[model samples]
Target chain A: MSDSDGRRGATRRGFIKGALAAGAGAASAGAAGAEAGDPAITELQPWMRAFGPGVDASPYGLPSEHESHVRRRYVEWLRPDTISAVNFTPIHQLDGIITPNGLCFERHHSGVALIDPGRHRLMINGLVDTPLVFTMEDLKRFPRENRIYFLECAANSGMEWRGPQLNGCQFTHGMIHNLMYTGIPLRHVLDEAGLKPGAKWLLAESADAAAMTRSIPLEKALDDCLLAFAMNGEALRPEQGYPLRLVVPGWEGNMWIKWLRRIEVGDRPWHQREETSKYTDLLGDGRTRRFTFEMDAKSVITSPSPQAPITHGPGPTIITGIAWSGRGTIARVDVTLDGGVNWHTARLSGPSFDKSLHRFYFEFDWDGRPMLLQSRAIDSTGYVQPTKDALRAVRGVSSGYHNNGIQTWAIDSEGRAENVEIS
Target chain B: MSRFRDLAALSLGVILAASAAFAQQGGKLGLGRPASPDELAAWDIDVRPDGLGLPEGRGDVLTGEELYTGLCAACHGDFGEGTGRLPALAGGEGTLTDEFPVKTVGSFWPYLSTVWDYVHRTMPYGNSQSLSDDEVYALTAYILYLNDLVDEDFVLTRENLPAIRLPNEGGFIPDDRAGTELPAFSAEPCMENCKDRVEITARAGALDVTPEAEER
Candidate 1:
């Protein structure tokens, strides 16, 4: 394939090598020529001659039009209809840890519900000393805190369990987003209505058409859970449960109920459909596993992937991606170039918080050789991300949830990449 | 050491007295009002496995058959076998250990209350919570009958619902991941020569699951 420079008949490896050598020769010549005579200083640019757009052109700003390609995408054949389907975050295009509010992935059981916050009421009953109902204003009166955390669907890399099933990292591992949520701690709200002696579990229910429900242990609800009202510094988007949602840190995304309307304190776990029939992981044996929450340590290289291929000839290349663990903060990430033969500890960039996405980078000079790229993450809990074979050995191929297998990107001689399974 | 222990005991006694005063103040932040019984009844629709929240209703399989054909047959075929991407509700009894298991209700579900609760909460796909109490009961009975769990003449009620046990009731085990999996996976990962040779076992491009990128 021809490169952007229209270098014909040269292989990708040859093109990169030749370009690098030519670049070095040109740089030396340009330095000597600059000492002889200055030229670029005499040129005038159009931006310096013209006035830019004034402020207030857009009261609420948006990403530049050049960034229009960055968007959530869905596979049409994955579901029967869009109402109960899922769309993936554009993780390949993102650099930092925080995913933009609008570009966050969407997974709806019965589509996004447009609830009127004015009419919405949160009811807390069942095994509480006082059954209480709070309006939006009343909810705001309670003490609140801000936290950054990642919400990962249990089925994030589920398609890869049997084998590599999606060509892009966006499809295989993009069912997650990290956000800064502003909300009141659930303990504060639950304490407002005193817990009874027998309270053991909680039923967090949504107000959408599906009325999605899941039973959470009372201890977790009283821990780091939040009744979130805002995300990423602004009111939550409608698709993100505008008025309120539950941020069950480190748990499965489905347990973080959106458009939350009621919380029932219970004496026993509610074997709802989500917990009993759907989310349960079927095993190689004839049994199933329930309440398989908490995503394990996982990582994936975002760029230089199938969707985001290497365009420029190799020089100073930055291999960057994200790593996260539901159990705790990511302790370290190791990147391998030739599959898992040799590894280099990647540099962890940006703020590292518990249960939040951590950005990592491995900067190196590329010599235009093909690579078998993979990243393995280890969390503070000392659990390392397992290989696909290692994971299959334990959980079997029947499990469609919690497939935190190490992903491999096969880079060809053309610097183009594709998803493949390695043994 | 005894003086230090006496001082610590005194401080603990004072803290207990302060907490007692706070408890007497009714744990009130004075934010939300007590919910009326009617409001609680309207939003509290969760059904436990013990049939705690089921409404008073009874429906026979014969009535369920008519209702299933009329209401559920559009997405879930006449025999509870799903059409398109809709979930299949029956006929996957012995397929759990197969290469590609069909985890339908009769085959994988561990509780019958979940079947009734799911229908009452979010069934008919689009028109959720639109079924009457009796209709939900009838649909549950029909689905059970479709899976051969119940006979055609069987009737379902809130009282006898919890007594019905699913075939896979004993198939579920609580998540032992922390105890079973954490130790095995917690070992220090090897850095060099983790494997002798790497081979491409499979390619996702060959599967053709990903959609083609649109021409920019």
Candidate 2:
């Protein structure tokens, strides 16, 4: 290859694979590859040369430039407007847990709200003995709590029911994000409002143009609902809620209204449209499943998933993924290679708490043969994830929401992983 | 960079000196004395749950319907069916077990207090409460009627607002996780040989993940 000749092209798969194996950020891989195996060339491009000065950086960072294409892939086959409905995370390309806040997938019925926190206020009225309005500053004066939790849209894996509808974890599971939040306990505000003796349920409403609202059971409200003001550590990013969001703990993400403005206490629930026509799951019969509040235990393998294939095979491969249970802590996660026939307990690699994402890993040797991979999670309450067949038997396939079925990715002899319907 | 740092340090020193200088200048910093009672009143409008901050005024259902039709109906729907993709504010009670549960104010909401508070703080879609306190009360009553929670004769005066009960009012319970659910896993310890090392028995494509789409 001559320097002036366009005859040589940048190395493709090998360059990518080698970069990943060498544990280098994707951006540095191009130069690193040119210097690899050559001491003199390595000397020419010192490691520090790969980075710019500190001031040249950003307070918040993004994925490596080489990964510019690693974004939500939309299905042109699905809609007229790209933003209206489409795109997913590159789950296969991501490592560890904690989806970067920006890269987390988004599905909005209405556009993101640009709310001004100064003009924000939360009102507690209705059947309450006392009605109160708390400004943003007033809310900050209350006792606060911090929690790490994952919010999964009811439709997180809904498309998969039809088959391996989408490849990559981003499309399948990017609908979820985990983060630590700072907020006042929902119970404190309810108490301050002086709940009436008969008050039993509450309605949470957003100030967004959508006026998104939902009725919540009093038990769930008082139990873990959080009036969250901070996400991660800083103020909530506008898209996530801005000044305030109702943290319904382990419940569906939609019910956690963002830009929260009101709470009405009452004796019973008000079945808003959000709880009915939308989030509700339809059955095979002419019926629907309503108020399906609790998110059962679930787990998904992130790496070696559809997007990330087995670039290096047949060796000491470390399989990692996230497992969580809305009901409680994940008691155990079992990895099975021969379908469900053979099972081995995987190691919980990172923190595993109630209602929070738990990272798990399993190390194994692949014999360069085609392998079937699956992970099963069991919650503290002895609730084990059901097989696809088991879940469909109960919920039926007529519904497009709440599809928490077991997920499987098939690997062929070529080492490429593809979404597959094993059921 | 050095010059900038020096400037910052000088500004800090100036602020420190200014604080002491103000004290020497006596009670008022020339900005005026501590805020007066009237000044405090001008900025204070926090409404308490016990009816602490309600402004002087009142509204009824007829007036509320007119205001709602003018300001709210465009997005919330003329009858609260809700605008496209937006939530339907009416219908759906006792439908929790159904596949398509329709939770509306009449059918599912637990309290009337939320209606009043929400309207006062944020409502009328984009404009948000161009109405006064009396207008907010009337609009709340009108919405209650559309949800079938109230008749046309119903009124939502502050005095009667707290007395109104919602259907799902008693449906909530606190999240008492301690004695109710899982046993405390927080304990002394167990780290050593609990398990030596983990081994993988499976991969992703080999087993079932999603259910059969055509089966249902």
Residue A294 in candidate 2, Cα distance off native in Å = 0.5
lDDT of each: 0.87, 0.66
For all the predictions, what are the DockQ values? 0.40, 0.05
Interface RMSD of each: 5.3, 12.9
Local accuracy of candidate 2 as per-residue lDDT tens digits, B1-216? 999888777776786676456445432222112333453343333233344445666666788789888887876789988776555677666664454555566655555665665566556544544567888888888888887777888777777776777676554333332332223322322323433343333433444342211100
Cα lDDT, model 1, residue A151: 95
- Model 1 residue runs over 4 Å out of place are A1-49, B1-26, B214-216
The top-ranked prediction according to lDDT is 1
Per-residue alpha-carbon lDDT of candidate 1 for residues A152-238, written as tens digits (9 for 90 to 100): 998898878899888888899999999999998888778889999999999999999999999999999988999999999899888
RMSD in angstroms, candidate 1?
Answer: 7.5
In each prediction, how many residue pairs overlap at the backbone (N, C-alpha, C within less than 3 A)? Answer: 0, 63
Number of the predicted model whose TM-score against the real structure is largest:
1
Instruction: List TM-score per model, in order.
Output: 0.90, 0.65
